[model samples]
Target: MQASDRYRLSASATWVASVQMEPAIGAVAANLARSIELVEMAAAQGAQLVVLPELANTGYMFESREEAYALAEPVPEGRSSQAWIALAQRLGIYLVAGISERAGGRLYNSALVTGPDGYLGTYRKLHLWGDENLYFEAGDLGLQVFDTELGRIGVAICYDGWFPEVYRRLALRGADIVAVPTNWVPMPGQTRDGAVIAHALTMGGAHSNGLTVVCADRIGTERGQTFVGRSVIVNSQGWTAAGPASVDQEEVLLAPIDVKATRRARQLNDFNHLLRDRRPDIYDEQSGATAGLRQR
Candidate 1:
């Protein structure tokens, strides 16, 4: 089948990468090394923007907060963050990789966005899942988008993908793409489309928000917790642009993402604009007057 025109023929598309891998518990150095190796592999494959899975530096499922604190390091200054930044600098590409962030007395789950020039910014996970709350404080940095030469890149981690508002806010703030660093667990049910139900959430977010999503998920069983890998890239129209990589294997998925195309797609037609047509005045979920939903 022929590909639909999502981008202008004249505009350059950036090749993006989603890397899925299993990280060992407490193997900080080794995990960072492996993550870098996977990123380098993606770089060699002509990927200009690469994303690694959540907690790629320190394994998820920490036994205690002390253990997590001991392993966590300050963002940008930490060895893991610095190493990823250095790799992006050396490869002359952009990267978003998850790390365990230590700031003063708190530890938060974070994704650091780095580019060829230097460190860009960090997006701390806004929504914590399962035992993450036990080891890390809820992210206070808010959902952040980094402006880069490739495009405006936003970030979200594992559980954050579950909230559609995360993507909506990013898109509202002018994000062209969202890099999801996730350690997705198996949902109870499967979808008819050959992907897990969790995959639907990411795709739905992309479609609804008009944001291209690059999700990097981890595989294998960790401390009795099993992760559903299937790393994927969803285009603005909610179609699978690249992978839903293997569920139990280390892998890299790459696809061309044109931000200009995404922007144009948000128009839908001459009379409608996806973001411009929003009725925030009618969506006062807090009051629950005209809206059926309530803010959590």
Candidate 2:
């Protein structure tokens, strides 16, 4: 069979990533209602999957862990997460949304993937920002790729995308498409200097993994911090299939992805996978102390 013929393709399915705009700070009710409205709107537009920005429910300026904890909810049962799950079930689609998670008396910055089958998976931000370490414990969960109606989908939150290891890990785990929901703050000169870096990260990850990478970053300012609103979708061969948008307004970017093509492209081109074919036997050699290690 042809390489493309060997893979599954669902032409009827469409994926939408909502660059959820932030409302006024501490406006929990407003944010909740806005998300629900977007869910309905996305469904009406024929989206089989939808992604939301980080910290969708609560604002990002919480001064203390206590405040964030007070808003966190369990993965399958928190009030906010329950609403998202119910929406996914009601809409009969897959939804990945970042939420402030509270579990076992601790707060976490987490993302949940819900489908018609209730909660599909959850990802806690493995990489935390500056003061984030003070409020929430860093997540020990590794990269994740969940089987969905659309395809094998990988999930990662904001800071997780900054490191190449995060993307490589997800790709190694067999991800066909990676969805990242972020509130990526753009530093003053980073945009000019960082465009190349950002492009390198996106293209390198996509080409190497043979997976389409879709990133949905928040627009507008939140908690007096500016965000880099360039939500984009890159194809397997390191091509920008979709765009790099502006940070000024609320926008919904759409792209029809061919998952089979991504796989085929990798095979036809024999794309960069040298990193995947490393000699672990020699790489794992433990050096520091032979006698002490053997004695212990």
Candidate 3:
């Protein structure tokens, strides 16, 4: 059979899509509308799971804490989260998108997960980057894996990908796919020809932990801060399945993945299983020492 024919015959394959778009600063209504539109388009193309960029509803780069608070809302009950939930239910698909969350007077950079059944869960950003610390509280909920009909889903936003422990923790919790809602910025000393460091970091995390990673990043400039838009989807083997979209365009990339395959691949030829081979005792002691030093 031809490759296309074989693909057509695979009933177990699931299609995942990443949406890369430019969000207008403080334009919640318009941004939500555009995101819903793009998700609809992806669903029409057979995408069962869709991921949107970080701060997708509320653009990044807040000038002050007051401004950030003005844009934040309660999750699942928030307007943006409700709209995404409605869209997911209407389309019979799973959706993951970022939002500015306000809870008990504190604002967190967060991502929400919704599916055909309605609201699922939220992941607060654990690592704040640059000016983000000025406005948003660091994540308190820690890493979370949501169980859905599609598979076990995990969520991380932007800078969380920088820490391998985030991926390792999720993978250990049986996460088959990790959805990253990110607003990536150019790193210091980055060159045009060089590979996107964020993308490389994601692939390495996925490969090392035997997990599928889907990143959705935004494009264009917001409040003079430019975002790097190269939304990518990596299979469990750490290979690009969909895209590293253009640096400045609205695009959707779709790819078929088998979540179960990732579990099998973790065995890695018996000699060196991804999760089985461990020297965690030594690392844990070292980590404790480092933490103690930082406390001093």
Candidate 4:
């Protein structure tokens, strides 16, 4: 190996992985075991950061609020979270996974972040989608970004991708990579032959924010609900670095990202910068113009 090539690789590369798996409804134990196996596999392939789909421990569909509450667990202290933290520490990798969180009498859709040291923090889903509103409260923790040896990491869950403000806020806070743990379902007008809208949304968010977006999605049908499995890793240029994995398969997508380089790429040209050129003041002032439309 050439010394120059080794030096370049060490300075510029960070490997990441996205795990797409199918979780049986209410099967917490089995799901956590599978997740650990997949993370180990990703680490074997040299992934420094590993991401898993939303609610990866407890499957997405719940028959009733009672069932959801029964499945929800405390963050970091939950058995599933502790297992993941131990795995991350043992493998010297970073892990971000979604879990149903129970706090007092309320349940929240949350994502847990852990690294080689231990639990970092959690990001509750800020936006609830469809039936999720029936079971979980909307997030109150706000947007969270964690600083680590790898880089600045941000987290978002499922439907949060539909809101542009989510990515903008993270970018404004200097996030280099955003790990999205999603459970994408077929939206209205979705067809088997068409491009998945979720994928398009993630790509747009990544390019606009100059953030590398890593999405880990679930597959398979649970109860009567079907999840669209198109887990993907998009580079800062809005290009697919790894997947959009099989629509109904369990797979791991691996990619190498240079977060520092992507952060620098935010400057589109000598005369333009993506975030700096934002006219936030004008938007805030004219926000009234859209108030009527919003009311409708």
Q: Give the TM-score of candidate 3.
A: 0.94
Best by lDDT: 4
lDDT of 1 by residue, 99-140 (tens): 999999999999888999989998899898988889889999
Tens-place lDDT per residue, model 2, 179-202, is 887777765468522583455677
Model 2 lDDT on a 0 to 1 scale: 0.73
Per-model root-mean-square deviation over C-alphas: 3.9, 5.7, 3.1, 3.1
**CA lDDT of each candidate?**
0.88, 0.73, 0.91, 0.92
Candidate 2 weakest ten by summed lDDT: 1-10
Query: In order, how many clashes per candidate?
Result: 0, 2, 0, 0
lDDT of 4 at 20: 96
The CA lDDT at 79 in model 1 is: 94
Q: What TM-score, computed on C-alpha atoms, does each candidate reach?
A: 0.92, 0.84, 0.94, 0.93
Candidate 4 local lDDT, 1-296, one digit each (tens): 34345336776788899999999889999999999999998888778999999999999998899999999999989899999999999999999999999998999999999999999999999999988999999999999899999899999999999999999999999899999999999999997547899889999999999999999999999989888898999999889999889889899998889977898899999999999999765575455546557779
Candidate 4 global TM-score: 0.93
Clashes of 3: 0
- Of 1 and 2, the candidate ahead on lDDT is 1
